[model samples]
Target: MSPAAGFARTLRAEWTKFRTVRGWVLGTVVAALLVPLLAAVSAAGSHASCDRNGVETACPEPPLGPDGHAVRDKFFFVHRTLDGDGSITVRLTSMSGIITYPPPDHDEIVPGLVPWAKAGVIVKASMEPGSSYAAVMVTGEHGVRMQHDYTGDVAGRPGGAPRWLRLTRAGETLTGYESADGRQWAEVAVVRLPDLPAEVEIGMFAASPGDLTVKQADLGGLIEQMRFTETTAVFDQVKVEGAAPGAWRHTDVSPTPGTNPGEVHHPGSAVESGGTFTVVGNGDIAPVGTDGGMAVELTLTGVLFALVVVVVVAVLFVTAEYRRGLVRVTLAASPRRGRVLAAKALVIGGVVFAAGLAASAVAMPVGKHLLRGNGNHVLPVPALTEVRVIAGVAALLAVSAVLALALGTLFRRSAAAVVTALALILLPHVLATASVLPVELSLWLLRVTPAAAFAVQQSIPEYPQVLDFYVPQGGYYPLPPWAGLGVLCCYAAFALALAVVRLKRRDA
Candidate 1:
């Protein structure tokens, strides 16, 4: 017989052995069942709502940007209609802000800017939230930037006040320029808006996001502190080259009041005197973070619980044969111990992969329904991303099972193999995510340990432009999804290699 046919027969025999054992079959079922069961439990305990005009209401979904993604569109505006091709120019003299209830010294509201605070000039599609727009701004600490459509940001120069900014619109394109003396200008950035309107709102704006501080909580996990903040900008030498030059209008955007917790309406204001403008505004214009909604993965927190059952089943699949002295009989039939080990790995890995995939597929939609029913806001993701998450979860379980089966082969004792496998995978997950240690150490464990594979479930990305508490406990893993999964794959390959050597050199 050909070697390929012989190996295929061995593979089929290994699979047959696994199914004939009722305990293994039942264990796999239980493992798959845990995913949705625990998902339901997690969804049941989760809840959210908003305070609207002294009454509670279901939290509103995040405003979708022109790109159809969730975005934060809360900021003050001093704008006027600009018809056709036009340009708006302004010189910012000073930019400042106030932070309410700052930590450590929580006794006083102090004067400051929280790095991302903005004072700028913008030309927007309309007054509506999350519409298309472009702006050239002087930030609190990030210097000057040209931002558009909530996600596009290009840096221009590095200073605060005494900066001149210009936003010009010609047809569908927008260009930003910056200067120090308001004479010689340097091009900052140019962006072409798809289907830009002939009439748009052009004006000055100010915004500051809440000040955030993260500290270790006494009860466990990181405690994020958010304090109220507002920013003010003084603009002089303001100029507009189109429609009724100085006809500016004041408007406060929605979500300014009667929404969100810890938010008390402080609708921004604008004052105009002798061609100088002072704009004061609170809130931010950027992509919404995890604070906006629970990630789809949060619905699959059950994956970890499911992983425990998979580990045990995989360990016993190999070790049970050794305990009954059946491994020797199988090896005699094959006359190739290495092929026998390979066959067992393939059989167990394939079974766990199918089980995990099925569990995740069912868990995703069902858990989402339960979560939404319980007032949990789920962050929406791209269709491709959703598919990657589901497949990745299955891949994680499969690789993990292969690793346990190899350990079972090496140790020949189910208990020691199970304990070791669990320690390698589960302990790191608990220590890193349970907030039992410092952030630095927790990050290190997740990056290096087998538990790093769990990064597959991270749906929300960490945006550098948006300031928020990012930690493992918040579903923010240190490594990118596939890269972290690679770490575990490397471990499994090394262990399987060691098991092959042991089987070749030692008695079964």
Candidate 2:
């Protein structure tokens, strides 16, 4: 017979044998069903107590984005209109605040402001959530910093020596400077805001991000709450040059409503106090938490666990034949042992692929629905990303199944093959993602191990601009989706090749 014809017959025989083994066939089906069912159960109880009755019940006007993440927009703005081009210079003498803990017994006084408590000079396009703006300020303990666009941060002098800050706007470009004496100025940062309007708000502003605490839920969910605090900063020597403007407007642009119901405290006008004003305000404008604060991806939560079933079934597909002495009869009929091995790998991989694809297709939408029904806000992604996740999952299962089969053929023992597959393919993923090891070692483990295939199912990305935990424990994959999966595919191909070589040389 032709090589192609002989391969076809081997594939048919392998398929018939797989179907006749009720245990293996049933295990595959159970894996497919268990993924979606477990996802549904996990999602059904994933609601936070604050979100149990929807976010509106507890926080009617919560600063939430389209993806239901708490946004950073509210801050106390004590700004004056700068028409055309101008510069705002201020001397920040001191910044202080008092923080409180959770309510009922929330009487603990920290006597210090949060780390990111800001008091500085800012030139903003507007008081919007994602508006273009820049500020040079003194933090509570982090010293001086120049921050802009809700993400970019430039460090200034540490230990809080320099108190003089100056922000100059030249058309679309904004330059920040820091100095101890005002005459000897050191450049802090220079940023250009695209299409910055001719008239903008330029003045001293103060804000505090407050204390944030995270509570772990019983069912693998995180509840995050931020306690708003009153931050006060005293700004003096407030000078506005190169601009023809009216009096400074004391706007209460505090992002956190009801935190400070009073207006911004301006001790005296600059004109009356010899170009010096004391401005007291509170609120913050920083990157929102993109870490565990976001809702979980319920659809893919059970994928790694389902892989256990896939590994066992795949190992059994080849090892069971050897265990029962059925491989001798099969090898007698098809003397081409390599072709028989290839046929078995193809049959098992294709079956697992179809099963995984169907399960993921049903899981994604249903899981999302259950999450929303449980009053959780699911993070939205592009349609192409959703497709990649589903397709990647199916490919991961299929390739891993083939790898297990190759191990089974080489070892010829079901227990040994299954344990080896788990050790090589799943253990590394668990360790890396659980943060059991250091981040560098965890990332290295994923880079070289077959468990890197788990990256294929990662939907979230780590953004440098966002200030959140970007570890694998927080759903951030070390490698790109396709690159990680490719590593697993290479390992599987190498193992299968070795298995074929052994089968060709050894007796059945």
lDDT of 2 by residue, 14-52 (tens): 999999989989999998998799888887877743432
TM-score of each: 0.95, 0.72
RMSD (Å) per prediction: 1.9, 5.9
lDDT of each: 0.87, 0.76
Q: Which stretches of candidate 1 lie over 4 Å from their true place?
A: 243-246, 260-265
Off by over 4 Å in 2: 1-30, 45-70, 82-87, 97-106, 140-144, 154-161, 168-200, 210-231, 241-244, 251-283, 290-293, 324-358, 380-392, 423-505
Clashing pairs in 2: 74-255, 75-255, 207-283
Q: How does model 1 score by TM-score?
A: 0.95
Best by lDDT: 1
Model 2 residue 339 CA deviation in Å: 6.9
Per-residue error at 250 for model 1, in Å?
A: 0.9
